[model samples]
Target: MSDKINWEYIKEFNDSIRTIWMPFGLPEIIDPSHSRFSNGVDIQPAWKIPPKIAISTTITGAMFSSRGNPNHPMTLEEISKSAREACEAGSPIVHIHVRDENGYNVLDPEKFHKVIDPLKRDFPDTVFDGCMCALDSAEWPHMESFLKEGLLEVTPINTVAVLYGDTLFAKPPYSMIEKTKICQDCGVKPQIAIYTDADVDNADRFLIKPGLLQKPYHWIILAAVPGCSPMQNPRQMVEGLMRTYNNIMDIDDTASVMVCAAGRASSYLATFAMLMGLHIRVGMEDTVWKWPHKDDKIVNNAEHFKLFKTMAGMLGREVMTPDEYRRMIGLPVRKK
Candidate 1:
């Protein structure tokens, strides 16, 4: 009895396995009605929307300087020129991190105005947003002034503290809430910067669930940045992004997710986001290299936009226009 095989038990087990594996029975064609077709009563799923991607170019950020790229825009004129080039390359959203005469990232209203005012005059339909600068109290006044002057149409609010090397970029719950209120009060849209999944939870608990952040929430899922939540492995980074995105969608189904990175992996992450019907942000702020493994540097923000446009074309997705992006993100289209 111990040596003999139990053929009856083996057959039963095999049948059970097959039943579990093929619950619906071997890929038979189903009725169109049984498909995800919108019935008369139920709302159509968001995936039904055609593939259109908003390309947001971060013209400059805390990373790049004269040290990284000799042509990295440091002056007002240079920054303005870079931003204009980005728009010409079909980026509807231009993200700025205004640098002073010394190239240090600052949130000065006047400094920002110098770069933005001219761009606004030229690309009236383009949306402008900027880095909030480490979530410091001293920076809030400048940010508020910038918003009040209508220089910025969108701004980021980091949800948690992140260590970019030894420096801690802190965003306490109280400060983040305050920042959200400021954005709301100033009529500027706030996009939450998520460095990790914890940041997403923090955003939900502090900004979202409390009714501070309303429907159709916007998010920037940041990854591959050093000293924060770096996912250097491509597979892990994609999986991490998927999880982070799912976490956000779990909380708010209507939330718009954008993917970005701080290294050579930026382009890949952006591509993945586009394939998933999400948005993308790319520029010198995220990466200076044209390719992940190559040393070929991106000479300007326009280059990033051009490459992103080509990728979008290859993916069968349209690059969204400035006014189209504005409407999608709930911003008013600017009049020329």
Candidate 2:
């Protein structure tokens, strides 16, 4: 054997990568005659996104309209419009959370219509993902609550889960697989989210026969929750995610991973996640400040995305556009 390693194959593989931008593949605006839905609908540049960064608008300007918007409140039409504008800025997967009439936290499906309706109307081309978090109990009895009171009534264009520690099952914990079934039944892909390694393990553990859990999940690592995960150890953050994703892949090769942000990890872990060939998720819900070091400074979701895009460029990586993301994730072509 030659002293040179298998370098030829590596070079060929590198050369095989086809990199190009797929602009919405539609015409531009001039004297506007149609209101988007007219003339077979064309996807515009504004409603497009770089594939690498799937901006999670949940915590940013979602649910609530503005930073100063009152608690126990619902998002205003202007705020939803702003969120859609942010989507236009470049959010491949727009993560949405609907505010309840209570105004403190997200509500069940009662207001799901009210929230998703405007977003669908505005960002018809962008992929919108909704949340289905069971904040109360997780007993067999509570399953119905999550369905009847939580995510049953509404049919999201897409569904997401935020299963957290100490929120549902404890002592070895259980899975809310029922939620995913409901979502699949509703014809929406589940945007499954996890915080810790075990949470991901739970997802990995329950792929096929889910008695109480969801399997075959589209995973997102929401790094460092307010009280659950600490933001100090970036290395630990990477190691834990590496272990979890690698472990899941080892068992089931089909699991797709998304690296999400919460607070300071939102600022720092962007590169590490990119290094792992994963996507980023940042928004107001995950973090309120622009960067970890900045003192109480606020940045909007789109701006945060631009920040991450700059990081990717500095590191010599290409951020995927909306069309690329849809193709990569096996999602359908977004209609204009």
> Best candidate per TM-score, number?
1
For model 1, which pairs clash?
A: none
Cα RMSD (angstroms) for every candidate in the order listed:
6.4, 14.9
lDDT of 1 by residue, 65-133 (tens): 777777677788888899989877768899998887778888877787788888888877878888775
- In order, the Cα lDDT scores of the candidates are 0.79, 0.53
Model 2 lDDT per residue over 1-336, tens place: 776798777677775647775544247445244343456554343322233544444433233234443221245443365466567776666665655444444544445556556666666666665555455564334334444533322222111233343343232233345555665554455554565555555554553334432344456666565444455677766676677667657755665566766656656675677766667776666655555555554455666666777777775556666666555555556655
Regions more than 4 Å wrong, model 1: 1-49, 134-137
TM-score of each: 0.83, 0.64
Q: Which 10-residue window in model 1 sums to the lowest lDDT? A: 25-34
lDDT, residue 189, candidate 2: 58
